[model samples]
Target: MDKFEQRLDQAARAAWLSYVGGRTQDEIASQLGVSRPGVQRLLALARQEGLVKVRIDHPIATCMMLSQQIGERFGLDFCDVVPVDTGTADSSYQYLAVAGAERLERYIERSAPLTLSLGSGRTVRAMVEALSRLDRPQHRFVSLVGNVARDGSSNRYDGIMVLADKTGGERFLLPAPVVAGSVEEKEAMLGQRLFHAVTDVALKAEAAFIGVGRIDRQAPLFQDHFINEGELDELLAMQAVGELLGWPMTQDGDVIDCSITRRVTSLPLELLRDQQLVALAGGREKAPAILAALRGGWLKGLVTDETAARFILDAES
Candidate 1:
């Protein structure tokens, strides 16, 4: 073989042994009958001459790129895009739960006390469940949504209690139904001293994690029986696309001024907007809702999957 060909072959072998075979420089040198420095030079030559190629086998690399693109496009401070699990029919919740738990861990691990607000939904519940148990009694958790439904049953997806249990932190839950019977009832409930006290603490939270719900027949509000069929139809007729913390909004992310909104007992969206609200939602069915929230600037951060992220970016484009 020619001198050039011999050098190239040696470099390729060294590169393969060092990178692909995970061999140390000393080990590679011994195998190739060269000094450790000579092995290093061969590896460097392989890289410089394009004889070695590196590729990440995991999907997180792609997800990170998508996260950056989405963050830049929406002017968000934080964004997490989880890999799409194509094998499963619906893996949005699975991946989002793990990613959301990791995100929450960052705040809970801090030693200083922090007040975190929470919104209820299957996604949020899943996230709480996925979180590892930690003793963070210095922190506090407050629910941004009421714990009760219209039928007097507890909201199944409410996660504040679970979060409190997991973290050993204090808990504050709104002592009213998700939606009151009437505006007068809502006003009376809101005026109560206990409710006022809870909201005061909620308003001062450092950050909040919420879930986005699409407004439709299958909306969480409708499915959970928080809102009746008539209310759902009204929201649909009003061009509502999504909801955050039970406040329905149009495609532009403007909260709809409907009777249902007036009866919603949760903290006002206007107030929540002033806080650092990060939404955890994904799935193709929720892309439009997620887009609306993004466009409306309702979220400072978002944790979603690549499928939904692509849809949101495409819709914005």
Candidate 2:
């Protein structure tokens, strides 16, 4: 072989020994009958010539670039982007939840007395359960929104319950409807001493987990009757596009002042906006809402899947 071909061949063997065979440079040098310094030079050449190219297909590394881009573009502090199977029925929600769980694990590992303001939803529930090996007895998880239905019903997937079950932390749940039937009822609930305790805990939370909610008629909150149809119509009429927790937000990420706002028992956005807020959402349909929240600077972090990240980038571009 020519000198170039011989060098390439030598580089390849050195790389194979060091990488796949997990051999030390000295070991490779002895086996290849070359000096250790010669093995190092060959390894460098392998890398330079792309002969030892190694591409990891892990979700963490793959999403890192996208995460950085989104974080910079939206002025966020942190972002966890995950690879997702867009063809799945849940629209990559499982992957998003897993990613959120991993991020949450990191936050929980920090020195205790950690207070978390949690939003109620299926995604948040999944995230709490996916968080394994966490036992923060000193930390606490408080609900940001009420889980009770207007008709004396309640959400079984309430995040407070799921979080409490997973962690040995204190759980403070606001036992009221997400939206009371009237402003008076909402005020009454908010005025209650029990309600203040939970809301206070949430307001002072060091971190918060929220879900981006779409305004489309297809939203679960609408279909489940948690929010009345007329309120949905009002949101649409007011040019509202989505919601952060239970508060309606415009496409520009501005919270709308509607009757829903007057009646929602959810913690005020003011309390959670500047906290270490991370929104867990995915699916192409939720991209717009997520972007709106990010634009409004309502979140410091985000946990989402690859398809949703791409969708946001595509929309921005």
Candidate 3:
């Protein structure tokens, strides 16, 4: 390898030792036969290169209280509140991804077979990347939403295949677009035998991890070109605050019954109401949408950052 490659390799090794192996800088220096200062620099290089992702395993008192309060208020079976990374301007998604990955790993580490459903989003994609590879062929990963766009291109954020690859498990993808040309087209796609088979697997999922999306011009649905500007304007006019599995919902968490929703191909929120639905979302921009989902009682669990958690609690108060 080139000298630069060697330096990168050393940096990665130093990072693994410090973060995953929990080695001190001095210990790393001894192991690598480098000076203590050299070890420190290598660790810094790792962080600079985005090779190290740090998450606090121990729960702080305030975060614990926030988690408890949110859970009790929302009737949630699970809630994890992570401290905001004050160093970074916006570390909401980063922290949420780490926490979500930890929770996903717990489910994948089980010995028995499991059916886990997932939704597509930037945060969920980051969670998949943060997840550690494990051998769990007995498990199955299924998509909770359609895996393609209106133009028939694959959704970049779909992580079912990646999860299956990581766990050596089976994967089932929904064979449709995020939204169809019309309500008839959506009904036809849902009526297909293959679509039914895949959704049947998703319906049996023991747990589902999804992302909450705000309803606005900057929304993922709009930004990703899944929905046109007119559709977004319609949602905005209807007092839509957020979306779950591509279904737009009002501030009260009621899924809006509109033209766009009629053409969405995602699994119905009603069918998932009683399932173990956990939303992995955060950031100040998504606070309102997250609150809407909680108010609707649609989520069984939530993984969020301190900022959004505070916003939700304050709004409810």
- Which residue runs does candidate 3 get wrong by more than 4 Å? 1-54, 86-89
Q: TM-score: which is higher, 1 or 3?
A: 3
- How do all models score by TM-score? 0.79, 0.78, 0.86
- Each prediction's Cα lDDT score? 0.87, 0.82, 0.90
For residues 205-233, what per-residue lDDT tens digits would candidate 2 score against the true structure?
Answer: 88888888888888766986868788789
Q: For model 3, where is the 10-residue window of minimal lDDT?
A: 48-57
What lDDT does model 1 reach? 0.87
**Per-prediction CA RMSD (Å):** 13.9, 13.6, 3.8
Pairs in clash, predicted candidate 1: none
lDDT of 1 by residue, 1-317 (tens): 59978998999999888888998999999999999999989988887665654433465787889899999988898999887877774655867887888888898999899999999888888788777778999999999889887767775446998899878999998888888988999989988999999999999998999999999878988998888899999999999999998889998988899989989988887887778899999888898899999888889999999889989877777
What C-alpha lDDT does candidate 2 achieve relative to the native structure? 0.82
Which of candidates 1 and 2 reaches a greater TM-score? 1
**Reference-based TM-score, model 1:** 0.79
Clash counts per candidate, in order, are 0, 0, 0
Q: For residues 47-68, what per-residue lDDT tens digits would candidate 3 score against the true structure?
A: 7655666666788999999999
